[model samples]
Target: MAVSLLCCDWLKEYKTRHRVGIQIRGTVESISKRFFTEVPCVGQVLGDSFAEIKSLGMPEHFCEDELLFILNTDKRKSLTLKYYARKILYFLRQQNILRSLKTFLEQPEEQQSALEGAVLVDQYCNPLADVTLEGISVQLDEMVEKVKKTLRLKNPSHPSLRCAQGFFSSKAMSIPISLSVLYMTLSHKLGLHLEPVNFPNHFLLRWCQRPRGEGNEKSYQLLRDSLDLYLTINPDNVQYLLLQARLYFHLGIWPEKVLDILQHIQALDPSQHGAVGYLVQHTLEHIQHKKHPVTPDEKRRSAPEHVEVQYSVGLIMKHKRSGYNCVIYGWDPKCTMSQEWITTMRVQQLSKGANQPFYNVLVQDGTCRYAAQENLEPHSAPLEIGHPEVGRYFSEFVETHYVANEELEMRYPEDTRETLGKVHELYHGLSLDSGHQDQASNQPNHTTNM
Candidate 1:
């Protein structure tokens, strides 16, 4: 109860000073730019993102400035690779959903900006439909207190069932932090005076003094400088570095800093050198699977002559050869079938049968099969694809079209691209200069951080 009051009061005072939380609204770039400038160390988050990628053996030198290229470029595709670069770019980008969050917080109306951030990942974009600002404040305060009581918080990814089910995975829990910087981004945006503390193995968010502006600024810079120094003096902070390295590995992302940290750990304790070093190397190769690429999915394809003819996943169509209604859910660029079928379709063109794309579909009665691209047509009849599971997999089942799930993840069999992965739901197409496109899209466009 006391915490809840404090939460409410703190918010009230913050809103009183700002008059409106206008700062919360903006495109992710705009918000991040402001956030990095205003909040501490957040500017380096783009570079730090590679820190997670680096552990998986991804190069620590992944480009930082190309983020805007993705924001500005048109969607390009490669029929040969069956890959969409824009989708990967979009998968990694985030919009500041803070405008919605700000309104949800009941902050007074101020000038609105772009409305986007990195913290607003693909999932958890929307708040529970009926929740209110004050209601969420009370709940957040309670949860924060609960977390404080246990003080056993762990990094995300391999989170304990309690934290996952209780806080992040549960829509009822009010907020989620897919990344630590996300929580810090939003907390500081809300004037919470929160700071990221490098607690031994994991990270923690703690309150810092706000009244002492100059002192706080000095101390914050000093703290940041010390971290830079420690990371530079690699041997001194091996354990802390190891904790971060392993943390990203568990989260299915790489942590390159792990290399620096690992070298020191192995050198200081050679007994661990062989085992730990080998395992880290194995994980890196596994994550960056160049050895077994199913396709050159990185290739981009502009609107080739028949790009529109290529049915998107979740598109309803009719199998011309079989004369059956079906929905297109996947595509296979090459066929990998057993001898029995190879014997049956001996005359089938190798381009379609052996080494070109075939449409993977769900038939009317609900079984999956691959049909040649030439043997399919856009369903012209006014019949609904009533496969019972259609509703389960698609966003909408309109008579004329199948609305794809907004968070639909693109996966291929070999798990190569799936390792490094692509961008999630392409909420905004290259038409991205207009962020309204995202809000207007069918995806649940709610926003909250930590």
Candidate 2:
């Protein structure tokens, strides 16, 4: 996954409070208010109409014409009241607006009274008597650009870009939730109709209107029927779904909702068991931790480790080719082609003074096997190296030629001493190397077999 293992801490905390039916009406109301009053002037325009829609309980008695009038009044010309009216009409049909209002009113009296305190005004009062589609489109385009510019400034290191980098560099999968949020915000500002798909463990956004249709004349009707068509087709574009999931997850969507999104993702890509498994495990871990106290060790053990290894190994390999690093492999009896093997690589560099040697070491496991490239000509490992056992044997040969006088105790530290010892224990007992050494030397210097 492109997601960082570093997010475990945050996810854990999120899981704890992400209980079902955790009402966030107050928070939503607060955001709605700020979005109207403190955000760009466009928000103020949309907020005003929305505020009226809320106050009147989105009356079933109110028709489209009246809503259009409220939106395009003399005070709200710049507001694109028709767009807001269309959105409100869509929400009413979807039952999202009325449902929200009902939920709000059903809350405790203090909560209900709190929402009522916010005043609704003609914040978008447009002096113009009539609005045209062309005008609305032009205004929406400008607003969309403004929102994009604002968000770029607000979150310079956006999560989507980060996720993309993660994918290219480490093969990690990250849900680009923030990017989806940006898309939604921009789409809303631009008056571009869209809908969020709640996929299992992910989210996706779809343009309500198709990019093309049977003909230009049919386009308007197609646009009007877009939502219904989308609901019927139920697109499952993986990339779009993942983006949506990330957005919802970042917005602190309920786990059930997140899972619903992810299930759809799983259905599309069954091999994505790793990602799905992590979601389920981590979410359960969150629930468990909340229900009871967990020790530091328990928490640590529950953390997802796959991406960490991938990231670390990727970093090590990036610098390995400069002859500035070396890898040491320790033998494990249980090791097999399917089992991951650990290798420690050290990056060599000079410290402040020439006399000070510095080494930054990373120990990790890689699924890529050295033997996988055996079919290639002049097949050789990039470093002309193998396990530490091979290095130790080569060291013995070096000792015979150049360091006979130097005692092993004087030259090797404890850790190195142990490594060399293991090498001797494994290979010294076998006479195969002793007998085949010359024969192997006589053969052409082809690739060393793993």
Candidate 3:
């Protein structure tokens, strides 16, 4: 039977080319200057004007400084600017500016300063989402308890205090943002100050403390030389500075205050690396694509191969007296064939009258073997079942019967035992083969021999 159903639909490209009804030509330099001048600062426009500009597709390369200036025009208290900055940052990530912003954000704070005022607050902030510092902090606390419980369960052998140590060392279970927030919350509750270090696809926390000394003179010296140096140098690192800014923002630090710190760092050093670039690029892209944005093209990627069936064969047994027929299907994707063979045997019995099931069982094995031989060079080693006793019996049976290694043994010790067990379990009235069981029972333990 032919199943004529839709497998997958190929995407059709739709092009909507529009001709410019009116054209104006200008020099590249002049166009660049005009572009900067025409792009309004984030808070300069009212709701209606902002909506119109957004509808027209936000132009690339706007003056971020001017936008900040406008945001701060009314004592740096423009709710409009705050709203847009969040929105822009979100938009930038959607537009694949994540990588760029991550890189820009990672640059030294001084270097980032060049971009501070230039990058509009609206470009990074959005007013639509009702996210609050308190709400996020509460969420962080909840997440921490969850992580701690999960870790305790996952590593019962480890001490409760040490359970979280694995989270730091093991790459397998890297701390996610959700977990980071929890850690941040826990730190606050425990009276330990810690900030999230936003690394790519992972997070780390940092804690700073002042050094102690006995007397005032010694304490002052230690504080100035050791404690002060450590405090001053630690946050100076680009990664640390960006993380501090993020932590401050989450802690309800004023947007302008955050910007001020960001600008100082940017001014000190401008080299772009890691998270900072991701933050910046994400902000810019968001501002430009607030509306009338183009849908990103989807790329078709190949799926990963999971299990491979190595080799397979079929066996048939005919009962002349009862007029019943039984077929045994066997396969080994890897050299270890026992599990697949057992499964196939059960399936064949269950599917005795079903054509599709029988054929599918046979065809799948054949396909797997063919693909393995053709695609894989010089064929990898067949899966070895690794059970020493089973291996010994198999070897002896092949030697005695002069059978090929691939052939299933008719009277192997393990097979005989399994077959006898199944017969006893399934057939209460019938007397089964005793000689095969006796032969298997007489075999010496291979573990002792080893």
For model 1, how does the per-residue alpha-carbon lDDT over 1-450 read when each residue is reduced to its tens digit?
Answer: 888886677766555434211211112223222221111221122323322223334221122123333333432211101111121222233112333333433433333221211122111222212334456657867887676556555533334434533333222343333456688888889977777765333354656642331112234323433343334334356555555456434433323444555676777767776656775896667445523534323211233522333445655577666687887655654455676776686626544555555666666754556677778776655355644334323445444445443223232222222211211222223235457666678677587876
**423-446 per-residue lDDT for model 3 (tens digits):** 344332232456567777899856
Which regions of candidate 1 deviate over 4 angstroms?
A: 1-272, 279-310, 317-352, 360-399, 402-450
In order, how many clashes per candidate?
23, 31, 56
- State TM-scores per candidate: 0.26, 0.20, 0.16
- Range of the 10 consecutive residues with the lowest summed lDDT in candidate 1: 76-85
If the candidates were sorted by their lDDT against the true structure, best first, what order would they fall in? Answer: 1, 2, 3
Best-to-worst order by TM-score is: 1, 2, 3
Better of 1 and 2 by TM-score: 1
Model 3 bad stretches (over 4 Å): 1-63, 76-96, 99-450
User: How displaced is residue 142 in candidate 2, in Å?
Assistant: 36
The C-alpha local distance difference test score for the whole of candidate 2 amounts to 0.35
Identify the candidate with maximal TM-score.
Answer: 1
Q: Is candidate 2 or candidate 3 better by TM-score?
A: 2
lDDT score of residue 268 within candidate 2: 93
